[model samples]
Target: MKFFLWVALVVFFSGCNNSEKENTEINGDIVYDMYKPSEMSILMNEMYDYNLKIKQEILEGKTPVNFPTNFLNIYTAELSEFKSRNETFQAYSSLFVENQKEICNTDAHSDISERYNNAINLCISCHKTECTGPIPKIKKLLIN
Candidate 1:
């Protein structure tokens, strides 16, 4: 009876381990170093959504009165494998943020649309190099 109990426990644990591994696979291939973004990813998604909405307003020929500001200062959870990716993102993001600042600080409406488009371009460039999976979604943010 004790021998049977030991065997059952071993079987259960082994099954659990295998399931965990299987859950991480895609198309029957094991993925390596998958970065699971933390809850902070939600905030990041929200930021992107906000930008998309603004872009839509621009496409309709309406100038947005308020622009996003200081979003990069907001902290988000980082993946270890994404250190280089994050750096690249930050570099491009700085340009986006600066453009936003300039738009907000000045009364000049002449180049506001152009600057907004430029910001989206930077976003696309970074995503193209680091993580191309979201290219489709990012492209949707383009104003023109």
Candidate 2:
């Protein structure tokens, strides 16, 4: 009876340890997961839309341009959605500073440029640490 009890205790403790180690797991099998593929596709679509807006903003010489009205709103919404998904998928903690923080407070072109650069850098930095496969495209986004 004592030997059986000891074995049970050992098994219970091992199970507890395993659960703790895998507590904050991510769905790494995103390729196979239906939701992940759709989510990634949506995020890419947003990025493409955002790229066009970025060009327009550069031409207009403004940060968060509202010329087309609702453009900024949609862009921000899409960016936030993608970022939220990325954060949720990351198992470990990561630091992603806001690149748009200063744009709202000021309307300076240079400040916008700086904020944009920082934001792109944040993407590059996170990708470098998490997914090195997209490093080339990410690096190209930075202001050289």
Candidate 3:
């Protein structure tokens, strides 16, 4: 009788453990389910941080000379699942790259501050049409 009771208890506990595992699998693990940013989102964030640093450099009377080559990836980076590339996005991205090059080119005729602000403005303009969520944050990148 004692042996049978012990085996039943063990079987009951083992069944409960199996049910718990099923529940976890069905509900998803919070740690692994966290939001993963798309490639474009990640690149845009890096660009924002890089631009913020450039802004500080300009404020301190220093010219930003380094152009992150990764900025070019904007043309190829993967956007969020719901977003798609369009003509307007391509146009704004091209203008952005042009303005960015001007900012980094020491020999360029344009004023550094104007070029920097234009690049930032391009970001705002593009976001206005596509993803307006970042407009307020991108606005902060403006020099003035």
Candidate 4:
């Protein structure tokens, strides 16, 4: 009986530890799963800030010396992986990526500003569908 009790306690404690590693326990009965942002989400927000600067330069009639091309390279791969999981996200990402590439390739101020406006529109379209909280800030990217 003593040996059996020791084995049971060891097994129970090990199982408890493993469960704790996977989830947070609340009220001894409820578990609230934790959510970590995907790599693409973090990269997207960073690029949004950079693109906002590009918008500002356009507004001031100043050409940007640097365009954030690396953002496209890094996020595209992650977006591909994420796309396999969520079709809606994939569709919006495709629109955003294509215009962003055009923005980088544009050299003439007239063309660059037009392409940047198009890219900002894509951002607005996507956010309107899934994440509406950023709509006001995104509107700031518009030329008008």
Task: Tell me the tens digit of each residue's lDDT in model 1 across 1-144.
Answer: 864554444434332112233224579854433334434354457668877777777677766766654365533445323243466666766776666555444576667668776777776776666545456777777666
Candidate No. with top TM-score: 3
By lDDT, the candidates rank as: 3, 4, 1, 2
* Residue-wise C-alpha lDDT for candidate 4, range 1-144, written one tens digit per residue: 864554444434332122234345577843434334456556766877888777877778766665566665543545312235367767877778787767766454557678888988998887776656557777887877
Of 2 and 4, the candidate ranking higher by lDDT: 4
Residue-by-residue lDDT tens digits, candidate 3, 1-144: 864554444434332111122122345632222235668878888999999998999989899888899999999998655457889989999999988878988997877889899889998888777767567778999977
lDDT of each: 0.57, 0.44, 0.75, 0.64
Ranking by TM-score: 3, 4, 1, 2
> What TM-score does structure 3 among the candidates reach?
0.74
* Model 4 misplaced regions, further than 4 Å: 1-25, 28-37, 65-67, 73-84, 107-110
10 residues in a row with least lDDT, candidate 4: 13-22
**What is candidate 2's lDDT per residue for 1-144, written digit by digit as tens?**
864554444434332112122223267521211122233435544653664467457557755633233323322343212235354334221233234343344655665666666666665665555445445655565544
**Candidates 1 and 2, the one with greater lDDT:** 1
TM-score of each: 0.58, 0.44, 0.74, 0.59
Q: What is the alpha-carbon lDDT of model 4 when measured against the actual structure?
A: 0.64
Candidate 2 vs candidate 4: the TM-score winner is 4
What ranges in model 2 sit over 4 Å off?
Answer: 1-36, 65-97, 107-110
